[model samples]
Target: MAVYRIGEILRMKREALGISREKLCEMSGEICSPQTLYRIECGKVKVKRETYQQLMSCMGQLPERSYASIIVPKNQYLSIKSDIYDHLVFGEFEKAEEKLLLLEQMMDRSYPRNRQYLMKYKATLAYKLNKIDAEEYQRILVEALRCTIPQWDEIDMAEWPYNEQEMEIIFDILHTYHALNLDEKYLDACLKLKMNIERHYMDDDYYVTWKNTVHAIISWIISNRHQYEQSIEYCENGIEQLKKYRIVGNVNRLVYDIFWCTRQKYIESNLPEKEQAPCNRQLAQAYYLSVAQNLQSQSEFIRKKVKQFDIKELFFL
Candidate 1:
């Protein structure tokens, strides 16, 4: 007998009947995930009263009509949050989407951050898959940001600092603006987010990852405004941070951004041969780095830019 509490009874009954957690979840119409059910059975999380009742009924156990005082553990919650992020970063979109569904069932609704992450991931996947247009993506992200930043639209991003989750939402916002070529918004956002990063620097693994991501993004943001020197500085900073943290996810893109800015600087300014040499070399290095990273899309993008701009100097140099 799993004699811990009322929650444990669900486990005991389910086991005695030989119904696995997945089976129970399916039988219960997936009102909760297998992990959620396991946590509930272990008294590790508090589900809604209705959810508890439905799950109990699925186990052929009559409800006691009493409240279940279960609460999900901190570590368990963090673990799931990290897992979802890992899935997203690793390009496992389907897995990430599925986990988001499970998390929606399992996570406590009272925590605003839970909803925030859920909304952000949902928006990200939808936009990535072309299921939603730019407006919809921005709308969902703004709502997600509103979960934590009530005055998100009116607030000055640099005026206040944000935590990890808020920064994550902002990162998505940055991506959206850049993709849509909303230069005014992108530049404004870049400055604000940069200030926030400086204000709240944590020694967390998650924080480090976001920091590197921001660095890569803001580099291009700076470059777009014809600030190539500053942009390359930001890119170099991103690369150094990646080395310090041993994170390889964005190193190639960071290098690409560096070349992007440098090549633009040389072409627009028509730098002397001495200066153009570095720019041409950087362009070649960027193309090779994209190939080395096995990112066909990025490599192709560089090739297109090279031909489009008649930057044949890269091939010769």
Candidate 2:
């Protein structure tokens, strides 16, 4: 019964970690009053979507959307959506489709926001199966997002209260555009994300992940112009911010980017190998972290780069 029963699970996790409601609320940047959290944990009230996610993130939970929000206010809908998401995540497309059909059968189709949410999952599944190209996937998501904010394309995002659901849709659109190598659109999305995060996601782990991504994208765009040192500066800034937030997953990737940029910068300057050893060592440390985390793909990619660069003496370095 993959139903989240989010309230119960949240309460259990909180207590298991010996966290009180007041302290958890404080960790969430006071997004909800302690009273509200108590009511939610007691199952006396349905929680807002973003509020619960914020608390969960603060509590060190996975920061991905795994269940439906309270917007639909139906347990059956939430359960089915959770199942669909899990199936999709685990590469069980056929089972995911079955669950999606079950969800479609029960979901109310009149509310536009709810409608867009459904379309979002559908487009994602289609894109995952290669039924649609990145541009088409982006087009579908943008249209869905416009259902809520008709001026999404033109409006300054800072003018509105940030909505996680909408932001997730925009991220989906950005992911597709990034894959398509639509640099202008990708840069615009990253900038909008940076503005939104700065304004709303105060002191949460999600903020660290999102901010790091924005920094990395900005660095990439600068690197494309051959501003390698400038790119390294952005990556280093991102690394420091990630450390300050006490997050780990994305830090090594930033280190890798820094190593990449420094290599390019040195090569472009005709620098001696002695000048390059530090970045090479930085590259080795990032590789070690990837392996420690069991991130096989990233570790393998880094290992291939070590070979390509003939990075000898990494074992001793």
Candidate 3:
């Protein structure tokens, strides 16, 4: 069993309600000492079956097994999340929508941590599908932010895999706010993203994936603003990071972003009309050729993404 997950679920639920450890013990009729409760919540000691039942019953939950047993297996949860992201990357919106529904159906609301992840993913998927308007997107994000337990210890977050998903959410917010021309909110999101990156203090040195993901988010966020030079730099940096810890899907995404940024920069350039037109055409042609070459060596799933782009109309310039 994932002791950390079990403890995090318990702690997040209790903290979300502003219930103190002493109050939790009192509510459970002091069935376990406060020190013991602390140990369980810290994942230093596993709660006994009876103790688990007693504590949960006090919290108004009645499960057939221990809280840990009711969780979706970590591997299965990760697989579902990864599959949804892959579908999105490949422009398989229909498949992404289907998998997201399966994920929602599989989610356990009793676990607030899972709910946090679900809300973020659902909001992103909804935006991608055009199922939510800008107002609805902001509303959903506000609600999602309000529910995250503020007191969660850094230790727990560092232990969790895919920590960069938080940065991705900020990127989504930055993009949305930019579209709405909400400069204040966009700047706030950018600052939050910076803080998030700086505060990540993992015990282990093997965090290449986290670093790559952060760079990718930075690249994508700036790309939305047509800040091509900075965006391209971040994209190149991210590509190098991915090279160090190569994942085909991630590499494909960074390259795609880089291509789009390059095309955007070309279109937005202030060169002489003659130079601008030729430059834009050259960039678009190169982008198409690069994508075609990359997809040609991949599976049909990836090749299908090529159909989504039309180089001729991609840059109005």
Candidate 4:
């Protein structure tokens, strides 16, 4: 049984409400001090059942149920939240907004800070609906950014895999809203944050993989923006760095493919005539061959691993 301490539950609820510790203390009319709340959330102290119920009741306005009944696997909650966020990023504003409301109700005030994310979703939804209230939307985004800033610091970027798919989804959202400048700023911030994470927390393997992934994506984005030279430079840098670390795996191979594809594309785009440049063609062919060989090796490796698995061990019979 995965039992959470009482304090942990309270803290999660407070965060879900998007209320800061100080704000929670104020809202609860000093029933709990910020320090006390922090202690409780951190599982340093036990909260009285009565006090817990009181706090829950105070913040349970959205969900007409007790927070205790809403417990489930943490990953399940994350998946649901990710799905809603995906919809928001994909321009399904109305549907996302509806889902956000439902999520809020389901959350029952757990992890109140997540309310910031919900607010961001609603603001973006409003923008999609042609509600030209830029001021309000920007305010919500700023609030969400404020909450996210600290989390960026906490994340272990090097070993922690980049959510490339989610990044693309967010990029699309910003593009749809004509917020390219904001998108660029966010990407730059993420890159810097990842660098910090690598510097402070990552092991060698993690650090190498993280750096390569960031560079590859950054290069891809710059290439799309017509900064071909800068893009190629980033890709080449990533490939060199990954090779130095000997990070041989699916991710490394993918990075290699991206580097070669982007390099070839950039060269092709710059050519003056229909005829292929000999140097460019040769380089492209080299990269293509490397990519094919890497993929073949990976497929063979996976087949061997699968062959080693004992299916009978999974069955009672």
Better of 1 and 2 by lDDT: 2
**lDDT of candidate 3 over 1-317, digit per residue (tens):** 11124565566556645678899899988988888889998989988888887876676544224223224655676577778888877778789888878877877876755666678778777877898887678667655643442333322322222233343554565678867977666655554555544444332222445455556766776778778889888767866765665544456556666766765666677544344344344345444444645653342333343354333443421
Residue ranges of candidate 3 with Cα displaced over 4 Å: 1-70, 73-83, 90-106, 150-165, 183-188, 203-207, 210-232, 246-317
Per-residue error for 97 in candidate 3, Å, reads 4.5
Ranking by TM-score: 2, 1, 3, 4
Candidate with maximal TM-score: 2
lDDT of 4 by residue, 1-317 (tens): 12224554455546645679888778777887888888888878878765676676676422222323233346456566667767765567777777677677666444444554555566667877878465556555655543423343343332322222223323333343335356566566556645643542324665566566656656656666767667667766766766687655434344444544554564667864343333333333334444555554544433343344321222110
Instruction: Order the candidate numbers by lDDT, best to worst.
Output: 2, 1, 3, 4
lDDT of each residue in 173-287, candidate 2, tens digit only: 7777779978787778677777866653333665667677778878888788788888888888888887787767777788888888888989999999889988877888788
User: How much lDDT does each candidate structure score?
Assistant: 0.71, 0.75, 0.60, 0.53
- Listed in order, each prediction's TM-score against the native is 0.57, 0.66, 0.49, 0.41
Clashes of each: 5, 0, 0, 14
lDDT of 1 by residue, 1-317 (tens): 01124564566556645679999899889999999888887778987788878876775544544322223454565466567777776678888788777767776877666677778888998887789988789889989888755656654666444555666677777778867878788877877777655543344555556667778777766777789999899889878877887776777788878877877777788876577666656667777766766767677777887787567744722
